[model samples]
Target: MKRTTIHISAALALLLGLAACTQDEAGFLPEGAEGTPIVFTATGLNPAATAAAGTRAPVDGNWEGVSLVGVLIGGTVKAYDVTPTTADNTSATLTSTDPHYWTNHDDITVTAWWPYTEGETTPPAVVVRADQSSPTDFEGSDFISAENQPVSYGNPTLRFTHRTARVTVVLTDYTEGMASVKLTGLSTENGNPAEIAPYDKGGDTYTALVAPQSVATGTAFITCAFTNGKVFVYKMKEATDWQAGEEYTYTVSLAAAKDPGYTVSEDGKTYEVYNAEGLKNIAELVNEEWKLGINITLTADIDLKGIDWTPIGKDNNKAYTGTFDGGGKTITGLTVTGSNKYAGLFGRIGSGGTVKNVVLEGVQITSDNSSGYASGVAGNSWGTIENCSVSGSVSGSFSVGGVVGYQFGGSITGCSSSASVKGTQRAGGVAGTTNSGATLTACYATGDVTVENDGTSYAWAGGIVGTNGGNSILACYAAGNVSGKGSGTIYVGGVVGENYATVTACYWSGLPDNDNGGATKVDGTNVTWQTAVAAMNAALSGKGWQYELKDGNSLPALKKEQ
Candidate 1:
C-alpha cells in the first residue's frame, strides 16, 4: 500500500509540472516564478513647451484607470488593468489574473487607453454630451518594450503617453453687456458625422478635446452675444495641424474683436454686421444686471471724489458676491457721507466674493446712523481680501474699520491699513470685528483707533481688530495708538481690544494711554517706541515679511507701501 501511494504522488507532481509548462509555452511563466513583475506608468503631456530651454516640461492633469493591451512577440495578446497607486497617477501597477507571467526574454508591444471596454478591436470614440463637465476627453498611446531586459524581481517599468490634443479658449478684456460667448464649427476635419462638444470652465473659459485632424481654412467661427441683442462672429484666418500630446490656448480679446476688420453679425440666425462698444464705467456696471459671481476688472484708476458715488449693494438684502480685480489700480479720494447702515465703496461683500490688488487712498467714509457700519473698502465682508491697502479715515456710530467693518468668515492676508478709525462701539484700523471663521495673517496697521461713547456702552478699539472672537491672527502687528474713552466698559489694545482665540507671533508698538486697556492675551508682545522699529523689522523679517526702511526715522513699511 505504501508503494502504491508513492506512485500516485509522483504522477500528480508530473501532471502539475506539465500544466505549468503548458502556461509557459503560451508566452507566460507560471505564477510564483523567480521573475520580475511588470509595472505600467501613465502621465499626461503638457499643452505647450516651457520657456526654459532643455528643461523637462510639466504634465497637465492626473490620469488613471487606463487599460493596457500587451502583445507578445509570438502575437499572443493579453489585457491588464492598470490603476494609479498615487494621487497624481505618475505610477501604476498592472493587475491580471492570467496564468502567464512576464519573463526576461520576452518582447512585447503595449497600447493604452482610458475608458476602454473589454474585447474591443478599437477604443470607442469619446462621446461628449452637451452637459458634460469641462476637461472631458479620452487619451490613447502605444509603446514597445525591447528584448534582453534584466531578470530582477519586480523591476520592469512601462510608460504610456497621450495621443490626443486639447484646446482652451479664454476671453479677455471683457466689457459690460456681454452675456455669453460660443464657439462653433468644431467638427471632424473630414466632414464626418463625428460630433465634438466643448465644455465650459466657468467665466469666459471653454475647453474641448479634439481628435488629431486638420481644420478647414476659414471654416471655424466664434460668436459673442451682448446684452443689447447683438452678435459678432470672428472667422479663423490661421490654421495648424492638431497633433497628439499637444495643448493649444487661444486668447480672444473683446477689445480687439470690436475692430471693424472682424465681421459682426446682427441677425441671431445669419451673419450680418453690427457695431459694438464696451460699457463706460463702474456706474454703468452697477446700473446693469450686476449679480453674484460676476467678474469685474478695473481698467484704469477711478477717482470717486468728483463723481456722485453710490456704493454697490448698499443693504443686507443685496450683497456683492462677485470678483473685483483692481488690476493694481488705485481708487483715490473716495468720500462717502450718509446716514445709511452700510457705507463704503462696496456696502456688503458676501461669501464667494473676492477683492484683491486694490489700493484706496485719501478716502473718507462717515455714517451718522446710531448703529451702522462704515469702512473704506466694504462695510461687511465674508470673503477673501488679499494684497489690498487702504489709507484713509472711517467714522461711524457702531462698527467702523479701514478695510472692512465686519469680517465674519474668510481670510484677510497680505494687507495693511493706515486709516484713522473712530466709532462709538467698535473701531479698528483694519477690521472692526472678526468671527470664528475669520483669519488675519501677515497684516499690519499704522493708523490710530479711537472708540468714544458717552452712555454706558461697550467700546472696543484696537489697532488691528476691535473684537476678536475665536479667530486666528498670525504674524501680524500694529504700530498705532489705540484709545477708548467711555464711561462704561472699554477695551483697548495695541493689537486687539479683546481676544478669545489664538494669536501667534503678533507684536504691538506704542503705549496704551488707558490703564484699563491692554492686549487681552499675554501672548501679544509689546515693544516700546524707541525699539519698536528695529524690533518690528527683526520680527517681521523672520516671518518672511517683505519690508524696507524708506526713511531713517519712519517705521519699516511694507514693500508695497502697506
Candidate 2:
C-alpha cells in the first residue's frame, strides 16, 4: 500500500470507414445488361497504440477478416470475402467468395463488419467471450461494423465503429516479482456480477473488452495481485456507464512489497521467504539447527536497506547444509562490517549444501581488522554453488574474494561476480584461495582484485583464484584489474596467482600476462571484453555451461532468469 497514485482516463473511440457488397445474377445489376466486376478496395484498419493483438487486423491499409455485403435495392443481398495482395499483409485486395457485378449505373445498399463468420447470410451478432486470456479472444471481442451505405458503380465507402468498449490496465513503477490483474464487479447482460479476465500484453500491460453496461459506485473493479502477497483494490467512487466505441485506461504505480509471513512451497520441502523479515527468519532457523537442512526459496526481491546483517552460517559447527534456491530473485542492500573469522552473506556452506540462481546486488561486506575469510557469497564454501552472481564491495584481511573467500574442497559452477575485493594475503575476483581438490568451471569475475603488500610471506592477487593449490580450474575467465597496494612484492596474475593441478581452456583479461608462481601466460587464453562471450561459451561447450554478455559488463556472465 505504499504507492497511492492511481490515474484513470477515458477517451472517445475512433471510427473506420469500410464498404462491402456481394455477387449474384439477381443482385448484380440492371436486367439484361452486361455487368462489370464491382471494385472493392479496403482501407483504415489500424490498431490502437500498444494494443495487445492490435496488429492482427486483416488490412495493411486494405482488407482482411472482412465480410462484404451488397444489398440490392429490391431487398436481395449477398456476402463476399477479401484477400490481401501483398505477402507482408500491408495491403489487401478483394477476392469475392461470391463474385458480384454492377451494370447501368445501378445503386444498392452495402454493409461490412469484422471479424467475419462464414455461412451467415447477414452481419454476425457481437460475440464477446467472458475470458480474454487468449489474445485472439480479446481481439475477437472487438466488434466493428459499417452498416447501410449506398454503393454505386465506382467504389463503395462506409464508416465503421467499435460496438464494444475497451479497458486497459497498466502497472507502473514495478520493481520486483510478477503481477496478476483481474477486473471484477462488471455485470453481464444477465445482470449478475461478472469476473473478466484480460489478455496480457507483456511489460505489465493487460487489456480486455466489455459490452456496454452500467456499473454502480463503490464497486470493487480492479484488483492487482502481486507475487509478494500484496493485493490492491481499486473501487469506483462514482457511477459510470460504459458506452460503445469508448476506451478506458487505468495506470497503477507499485511500491516495494512487505513481508508476506510464512509460506510453504507445494513440495513442502522448500519454504518461501518474501521480504527482509522472512529472509532473516530463515537465517535464524537454520542457525539454530532446527531447520538446518530444510530447503528455502525466495519468492520476491528483498531489500535490506543498508542494515547490518549477520551471515547465515555464522557458526561453522552449525553451517548451512540445505539448498537455497533464489528462484531467480535478487537480494539487495546486504551490508556487513566485521572482523570475524568467517564473513559473507553466508559464513560457511557445509557438505551436501547447494545454492543456486541467487543474485546479490549492492552488497557491502568488509572485515578490516584481524584475519578473516570474506566474500560476497560465502566465506568458506565446502559445498556446491551454481548460477549465482554478486555485485558490490568485499574486503578482508587474509582470504578475500568477490564470490567465496575460500573453496575448501567443493565445486563452483556457472557463477560470476563483479565486486571489488581487497586482502592482505590471498585475494581474487572470484575466490581468495582454493585447495583440497576443489573444482571451478564456467565462471568469470570482473571486479578489481587488490592484494595489500603488507609484507606477508605469501600475498597474491589474481583475476580468478588468489592461489590455486592443485585444484581443477576449467572454462573460466577474469576481466578485472589486479594490482598490489602498499609496499613489498605481492604476486599477481591475470588468471591465477598460482596453479598446481589442472588448468584447461581458462582465460584472463585483467593482467598483462598470465605469468605467476605456477602457470604462466602460455597456460591461459587472453580475450578482450568484446570478444569474451563467444570464447567463454566455446570453451564451456560440451561442459554443460554457456556464457552471455550483459549490458555494461566487461566479462561474460552466467545466465540467470529474471
Candidate 3:
C-alpha cells in the first residue's frame, strides 16, 4: 500500500471517447488533435527549514510501504516536487519510487535545471548527477543510464492531475524530521464522491482521507495544480506502490512508479528493469524462477534475444503489463523453447491484458509429455491478443497449437500463425483445444499440422481447432496439411476437425492427401471439400467475414463484442 500518484486528463478522455464512437464510421477521419505540453520545476530543502523532530519516524507512524522521498543529489539533499507550466497538454515528467539515498536533518536543495537531454543512445547510462551536502556542487553523484549507456538527463518526468487540478507530492524519501509528508496546492475539479476508509498493514493503522466530497459538483479529473491555476493531468499505470507505510490511504492523488529504465536488478531470479534504451526485448529483463510483478512501457524497440519460457511452479507467477510501441518496428527474431507439457512464454496468464506488435518466432519444441496444455506464446489463453503472429514448430504427445494449446474463453483478433504443429491428440494451428466460448477473427494459419497415435481414443483435431466444442471461428482461413489416426473416432478438417458448434466465414483449402485425407474425418463420417466450403460460406452471409470466402473480403472486420 505505497503512496503512489496518478493523474487523469479531462480533454484526453473526451477525445478518446469521441474516437471510439467514430471508429466504425465509414468515412471517419482521425483528428490530428495534439496534446498539450507542460514544464517542471524542482523544489529544494532550505537550510533553516525545521520540522518536529522524529515526527514521521520510519518505524513510528502508521506506515504503508517503502518509498524514496529524499535523495543526495549533487552533494545536497533535494525535496521532490512537481511544478506546472504552459504547453501543459503534451509532455510529462518521469520519476520513480525506487530506493534512493535519504537522511534526516540533512540540508539538501532540489534545484531545477533546463533542457535535460541525453547524448547516448543506449540505456542504463549515467545521465544526471545528484550529489550531497549542497545542491550547488556535485560531490557524490549518481548517474542515470539507459540501455546500459551513459545518457544525458532528458525532460522532467512529472504527473499532472486532471480531475482535482491539484499537484500531488509523491513522497519518495521520507524522514521523521519532516513531521509528516503533506500535499498542498489544490484547485476545483469535480471527481467521484467517496469517503476515506481505515486500513492496517504492519503494526500501524491509517485512514485514506480524501478531500471532502462536497469539494466540487462537476466532473473532476485528477490534475496537478501549481501555485497559479496551471493544471495538468496524468493517469496511473500500475496497481501497487512501494511507499514506506503500513497502509496507504489515497485521497484522490497521484503516485510515482518504479522507473523501468535505470533500475538495479535486485537478484538474478527476478525480472530486471533496464534503463529506457536497454530494453531490447521481452527476454532481456525477465526470468522463470522468480515471481516479481512489474508493469512497464517502452518508448523504443525491445529485443527478446531468443529466450524460452520457464516452467510454472509455485515460485513463478510474475505478471507483466504495459504498452510497448515499436514505432512501427517489427518484433521478430525471437524464440520460446520448452520441453515439458506445461511450458510457455506466459505459462499461467491469469490477468486480462494485451501483448501486441510482437512475434513469437522460431519456437522449437521436443518433449510431448504434458499433464495439461502448452503453446507458443501461452500455455493456456484466457485473455486477448491482437496484431501479433507466431512461426514455430511444436511437437507434443497431447494438446498443442502454434499460438495456444488450450483456450478457455477470451478472443484472438488481427493475428496469424505459420508454424509446423504436431500433437498426440488435440492439435490445431491456432488453438488445439477450447473449453469456453472464444472468438478467432481475421486470423489465418499456414502450418503443417499433424496428430500422432498415442494408443488412445482421439476426438478432435483440425487445422483451426482440434475439436469445436463450442468456440466460434470467424473470418479465419487455414492452409495446413493435417494428418491423424484415431481408434475410437477422429475429426480433421481444413478449418476444424469436428464442429459441434458454429464455423462461420472461414475457408479451408487443406486437401487430404494419400497420407492425410481429403476433408474432415468425423466419426468415420467425412464431409467433402464442396460440402465444407458450402457450409462455411453459408455462415458468412452478412458478417464482416464474408470477404474470407472465395468472392468476399480478404480479412475480417473486428466485431463489437470481440
Candidate 4:
C-alpha cells in the first residue's frame, strides 16, 4: 500500500507585524495587568496542495481567500479567518471575529482545527458522509486538527494534521465519465450503510476520505464498476488497521468478471437482482419456499430470451405478497404460454403486495383454457400495481388485458399498457373486470381491445376496462379502438363496456361505433393525443402524480418513466 498525507505547518512567523512594536501598541498589557486582545498570524506550508471547492483552503500554493480555522484556549473557543499576505502565499494573516484576550501572563494551551462550528463550544462530530462525489462535499467531510499545541501571541505557529485516512482506487482501465467505484463491505448497522463515493479527479484518479477504522481480513472493500457493465471487487487478503494521518492506495487490474449477479444486503431481507436467473429465484422463493415478505429490486435490465417463465404466485391462496421495486429497469421478451388459470408475470398479487417501476416490453402471454386469465403484469391483482407498463400482445379465453386480467379489491395507480389484447369473455386494454372497490388512478392504455367468440356467448370489450363493476376510475384515458366480432350481443365502449363505478375525469379516443355498452362516449376535447398529456396532468393534480412524454414518444408517460 502506498501512502500520502495532508499535513500543514507554518514556514515563517512574524509577531505584531513589526519587531520594534511595544506591548501597549500590540494591545498586550503587562503580566497580570488588564486583559489584552490576542493578535494572530498563521504562516503557510512549504509544498503546494490542492483544495476542494468550498473548504477555502490553499490550492496550488495560493489560498482561496479567507480560510476558517477554530482556536481553543482553555475553556474558550474562537474563530480565526485567515487570508493570504504574500504573493507566493507563504505568509498569511489570521483574524478572529469574537476575539479572545490574554488575561494573565500564564500561557494557555491552545488547540485548533480547520473549520469552526457556530454557536457550539464542543468539537464537531465526526460522522462521515456516504456521498463525496462533489469536491465541496468531499472537502467538507475532512476534519483536520492541531491538538494541544503551544501558541505564541506575537507569532502563533498553528499546523493542521489529517484526522482521517485517505483511500485511493486506481482502475487500470478507467475511462473519463464512464466508470465509477464505491467502497463497500464496511461495517453497517441500525439501517445505516457506509456508502463511500470516490472523489473524481479527472481521468483515472479517484480518492476517498475514510474514517479511521479496522478493515477485517478478507473483506472486499473496493468495488470497481467497469464501463462495460462488469464489476470487479478487490478484497483485503490481510487485515489492515487504518489510522489517522495515513493514506492507502489500491491499484486494480482484473480481466475477468467477479460479481455473482445477486448482491444480498447484510440483513438478508433485500436482494439487488442483476440478471434473469436472480429474478426467477425470487419467484421460486415467493411461491415454492413461501418467502412472501422478502423485498426484491432490479439493478439492471434483464433479457428473458430462452428461459421458460413461471409466474411468481400459483393462485389466490399462494399469491405473491412481497414488494418488488424494479428501479426503473426493463424486462424484455417475456413469453408466458400455458393452459393454467391466473397467469402473467405474476399469477396473483395478494393483499399488501406491491409492484412498481417496471417495464415489460415485447411480451406474449397466451392462455389455452377457456376459463383461464392472462395479462402482462398479473392475471389477478388484489394488491397495488404502480408505475408499470407493458407492450406486445396478450390473448386468453375468459378475461384478458394488457396489464391485468382481473383486478379486485386492490388499487392500480400510474400504470400503462400498450399491448394488443384478444379474448372471448371480457377483454380490455388495462383491466378486464375491476370490482370490489378497485381503484384506478392516472392510468392509461393504448391497445386495440377485441372480443372474439369461439364457443362463448355474449362478449364485452373496452378501451380502459371491460367492466367497471362499481369501482373507481379517476383521471385515466385509453387511446385504442375497442371492438367486438363473431359474438352474440357484442358490447363495446371507449372507456368501459359496463359502468357501475365512479368515473371522474376519464377520457378515451375513437371507440364504440354504436353504444358505449350502456355508458357515455368520449369526445375530441380529451381524446386528442397532442393535448391529452397536459389535460390529464391537470386532471391528476394533487393525486401525487403527473404525466410527461418519455423519450420523444407522443404518448403520455408517468413520472416513473422519467
- Give the lowest summed-lDDT range of ten residues in model 1: 270-279
lDDT of 4: 0.75
Q: Is candidate 2 or candidate 3 better by TM-score?
A: 2
lDDT of each: 0.64, 0.72, 0.45, 0.75
TM-scores, all models, native as reference: 0.47, 0.51, 0.42, 0.52
Give the Cα-based TM-score of candidate 2 against the true structure.
0.51
Tell me model 2's lDDT, rounded to 2 decimals: 0.72
RMSD of each: 25.1, 23.6, 31.0, 22.8
lDDT per residue, candidate 3, 1-562, as tens digits?
1222222465678889989777634333233232111122221111111113211112111111112223224543333322222232122232433322322223333332221233321222122221111322211122111111111123332211111111122322211122222222222224322221122222222222222222222323233334333344433334333121112333333222222243333652223333323343233343442322343333444445454445332112443333322223343444444455554555544446444555566666544465556566566666665666678786665677777777667776666678887877788888787667877766667887887765666645678777665567765667777877646556667777666566665656564522122233322136443454455445544543322324332322222222
Backbone Cα, N, C clashes tallied per candidate: 0, 6, 95, 0
Candidate no. 4 TM-score:
0.52
Q: Which regions in candidate 1 have their CA more than 4 angstroms from the true location?
A: 1-288, 513-545, 550-552, 560-562
- Model 1 lDDT, residue 224, Cα: 72
Worst 10 residues of 2 by lDDT: 9-18
Lowest lDDT 10-residue stretch of candidate 4: 4-13
lDDT of 1 by residue, 408-487 (tens): 89888778889999998888888888885798877888898999976668888888888876378776667778897868
Better of 3 and 4 by TM-score: 4
- Identify the leading candidate in terms of lDDT: 4
Give candidate 3 misplaced runs (Cα > 4 Å). 1-329, 485-489, 513-562
* Candidate 4, residue 307: how far the Cα is off, in Å: 1.8
The stretch of ten residues in a row with the least summed lDDT in candidate 3 is 159-168
What would the per-residue lDDT of candidate 4 be over residues 460-532, giving only the tens digit for each residue?
7888888778478877888799888883777788888767788877777657654343323445453354466
lDDT of 2 by residue, 1-562 (tens): 3233222111111111111233442355545355665556544454432134343232122344444433232344445455655654434454464456665566767666666555555556555777787866766567766567677666654445566777778878763665667888787664423777888878888888877787788999888776867887788878887766666777866643434344766876677888888888777777775576779888899898667888888866868889999888999988889666788878889989888888999989988756689988898889998888999999898889888899988898888998998899989888899889888888888888988877646688888888888378877787778887777777888878766767766777556464543332322345354455565577677777877767743345566333
